[model samples]
Target: MTQEILRAEGLRKSFPGVQALDGVDLTLRPGEVHVLLGENGAGKSTLIKMLSGAHHPDEGRVLLDGQPVDIRDARTAQRLGIATIYQEFNLVPQLTVAENLALGRPPRRFGFVDTRAMRRQAAELLARVGVDVDPATPIAGLGIARMQMVEIAKALALNARILIMDEPTAVLTTGEVDRLFAIVRQLRDAGVAVVFITHHLEEIAEIGDRVTVLRDGRSVAEVAADTPQNELIRLMVGRPIDQQFPRRPAEVGEALLTVRGLSRRGAFDDVSFEVRAGEVVGVAGLVGAGRTEVARAVFGADRYDSGQVSVRGETLARADVHAAMRAGLGLVPEDRKGQGLVLGDDVAANLGLVTLRRATRAGFVDLRAQRRAAAKVAEQLAIRMTGLDQEVRTLSGGNQQKVVIGKWLVAEAGVLILDEPTRGIDVGAKVEIYQLINALTDSGRAVLMISSDLPEILGMSDRILVMARGRLVGELPAAQATQDAVMELAVTDVEASRVQ
Candidate 1:
């Protein structure tokens, strides 16, 4: 019989406003890859945080190799061989890769730190992840994908026996994801139990050996990875999600947005497209394909060398975010915490961000007006919290995303640009978002959606545009678009396509 490496029983946690987890239980065996699944408000993160010692459970017990242990803090958990890689990276940008890897336990000799020894250790860890990088390089100079690799190395260096990864592939390309899977397999072969948490269903089948479904802070079911896909999805969603994406009838109206000869130096170039009112135009491509960059340029977040963005035939100025807003455009960025929300604020406060002026009276803040407006959308989105005053940081990943989308919903713009809007969200939340998108178009608003998930793009888009490197390569009608076609365009090899 395989030995159980880690176990949590009757886990319970609560805050002033919400009971994040309630009587959750999980168990893992050595050399096994266990997947955790739930919808946005299902309490997956809260449970992981408790298991990793980021938060103490109000009630429950944790067992490591049949021994009960008291883990009050992250350091204690690390000492007990549990390493957690959160979705939001915790690396210091100013530090060198080697120094960051050996921050807490650097080798010391003769009252001096051993720099050569640190580099050797960092390099070996990087090699394990199939990443080749100079240990002397500063982390800030590295891209998001490379930084993720460094995080994996740091986790391994700690001799972690039970590793927890949250949304590990949210920022990786296909090739990088494959490389990561190989390392995960190696770890499992060496008897390291892994608790994998992801929004991608395909990954559960690809890397997971067993699956545990969580619903409203409880373990609903546990099964082998080979369990039928529809059955597993039903367990997590609490309903038969026969299809991940549901198509809506499209009525492409008058062109609401037109981008002509859009070019930005070293980012995107000569991109042109038209989005009609009551239509969704999907931008599909692999990572670094300039999909998000295009949305940024259109929304005036980045400067463009040459291009004309028009709403209802009126030209928009470059690098003018305020002007873009005035021209009836709203952008839901990919990086929610970094660019989407004020993490330290409450849900009502974040919801009032876009239209704060409207909620004020004669330069005096109107508390009632802000609450009334925020409460309406909060209810519409079904955001679960004690009240609107609850901190956004305490909410689940899906709830955080809802707040981000709620801001735009209240904006009521003529044009909406969403970048990876459904990423890291659970199946039920994704379905809600899809319905919301349909409502947006039904109300005569145009949507420019940038997503890496092919099913989302093909099912929701009235038309699709694919980009590779920095150039737009192909456009397909939603009826004709398929997973294979989008992949072809995203990974196409054209020498001139790479961005500088």
Candidate 2:
């Protein structure tokens, strides 16, 4: 029999009011990719947290190579050859690639920092992951793909036997993703056990060997990826879901938001688009196509070197988030934890963030009014929380996203820029968010959505714009949108084609 690299029997975890994991069982075979599937709040995150030592299992046991192991924390997990690469990287931007690669285990000589040796070691590690980057360069200078490669290299350097990758391709281009897959295949051939988690169905067909379904904190079933996509979706979602996006027809009104010749140096250039009230306009592209940058520039969070933005035909200045907000623009950023909310704060405080001025008297927060307003918004969003006073960190990924979105809905915006709004959440919450977006348009709000998810853009948007290398490559009406068409535009060079 093939060796079982890792095994979890009757694993369980519980919080104050939620049983995040109830008797979950997972088996990882050597040299195989085990894909975990679930909706948001299905306890998928909790199970991985226990595996990576971020959380202790309330019951049952974990065994590595047929021997029981106690993983108390992240450090202990790392020491035990279990390495996790989360959707969000844990690299220090200020440090050089070499320093980041050799962090905590840097080579030292005569009590002096050994920069030369560190760079050499970092270069070797990067090469192993198929990344050709200068180790001496600071991490902030690398693109998102290269940064992700650095993360993979860091894990490999620790001699990890079990690798956990969450949404690994969410921010990667086709070329970069192919290279990463090559590395993953290499690891699998070398007898490494990989636990893969993602929402993209095609990825499961491409890389997965065995699949396990989790629903509402319990293991539902396990199957081979060769099983029909519809069947897999049914198992993951716990029901038959036909074509994920269900968009409703909304009458388009006058142009509520407009951008002409929008340019942000080294980011997006000449991004021009218009959105009418009661319309959903989607910006689609491969990773690093400047979709998020365009959203930020239009929302006044980032400066545009040259551009023209108009709200109902009135010109507005760039690089002013507060001005944009006051002018009826709301932005739901891509990185929720970094740009969305204060995770340490309570739900009430987070919900009241944007409208705090109205709930404050002479610079002092009116606690009662803030709490009352937050409760109302929470109730409307259907956020599952014990109460308004609960900490934001305690909520699941879907609820946290709801809290971020609720902040915008509380203060109605004429134009809402939602970047990757349904990312990292489950299918159930995705449906809720879709309904919420529809409700926004029904209320005469224009939505500019940025997403790498092709099906989502095709389903939710009235029209779609595909970007490639900081330029808008092509435009497609929703009725004509297709995945292959978007991929063609996303990979082509727009400037070279114009010359042709």
Candidate 3:
């Protein structure tokens, strides 16, 4: 029988305006992956923080091997064989891999720092996590996947018995995700208890041993890993999501946005596609396949060495974002927090950012007009918030995404380019976003969506375009597209350039 390594009972934590966690319970046994499922603000982060000693639960007891203990800080948690790998890594980028691994506890000889010993230990830890890199290599040079491996190595170096991975695969490619899962399974077999958190419902059956669902800051359900997907969705959002993708039939009018021979040297090359009015065009590819690069180039966020981007038969100037915006184009960037939304501002402020000039009257701002526009978009997108004045940073992931999309709606953009539109958001929010997409296309706007989710691409897209090695390799109508067909074009080379 497996032993329960960590247990939390009736965990309750409260911030000034929010009761982040209300009577949450969790039990993690050695040699099993316990998936923690919840929408953003459903208290998953709060529970994890409490478990990792970043926060103290108001009313709860945490047990280690059935013995009650006080976890006052991160240091204390680490000492007690618990470590957390957050979505955003905790590694110092300026430092070398070895230095980062031995951050708090460096090897010492005769009261002097022992660099050689530290490097040796770091090398061993890196190998254990299946990371192939020099110990002396700077952390800044490593990619997201490698950085994650380093984090796991650091945790293992600290002798962690209970590992908490919070959205570990959120930013990874398909291949990278598979490798990470292998490492996770290896750790589980070695008797490490892992608390995994993710927004992707498909990942549960792939790696999880058991599942726990949280709703409105409470533990709503716990089930076996093999539970049906619909039941899990029901427990999570308090309703059954019968249709995951709410796609309407494409109207397929004249091309609203056309890209011809679009090329960004070293990023993407000879990428060409057309998004018709009332149509949804999806760009699908593995990471580093230049899907995002193509989107950015078309939107004028990045310079394209060679290309013609024409909207309604008018050619746009190269690398000019203002021109793109003025030509009825808007891009919801992949990095929503960094490029999409101004997190420090309130909902009204962010919603009005793209349309501020229109809301201005002869050197004076119209607050009423801004608020009205914000209110209209907020209602259209069903953005859940305390008020229009609520800071964007404090909102949930789904609501934050809505605000980003809502900005374009307020801008009256005719062409919308969305990169990773449904990434890192919950199922309920995904459905809502899909409904919004359908609404947009139904209203005769063109949508060019770049997504990693296969089902999303197949369901919402009128036609799917696949990229490989920075080139458009294939295209398929939605009726003819399958996961296998898309994956083939995404990864492998084809003799012919396009798939009609």
- lDDT (tens digit, per residue) of candidate 2 on 392-473: 9888788999999998877767888999998787677888899888888998988999887788889999999999999998
List all candidate RMSDs to the true structure. Answer: 2.4, 2.2, 3.0
lDDT of 2: 0.87
Q: How are the candidates ranked when ordered by TM-score, highest leading?
A: 1, 2, 3
- lDDT of each residue in 292-370, candidate 1, tens digit only: 8889999999999998999899999998988888888999998888899999999999988888866678888887877
lDDT for every model? 0.87, 0.87, 0.89
lDDT of 1: 0.87
TM-score of each: 0.94, 0.94, 0.91
Q: Per-residue CA lDDT of candidate 3, range 1-500, in tens?
A: 67788889999988757788899999999999999998877988889888889999899899999999999999999989999988658999899999999998999999988999999999999887667899999999775557878887887776679999988877676777888899889889998999999988889999999999999899998999889899999899998888988798767788999999998778888878889999999999887788887888888888989879999999999999899999999999877886898999999999999988877889898999889989999998989888899999888888999999999999999999999898778888888999999889989999999987788899899899999889888999998999999998887763354452
* TM-score head-to-head 2 vs 3, winner: 2
- Ten-residue segment with the worst summed lDDT in candidate 3? 491-500
In candidate 1, stretches whose alpha carbon ends up further than 4 angstroms from where it belongs are: 107-110, 114-120, 132-137, 358-361, 496-500
**Residue 169 displacement (Å), model 3:** 2.1
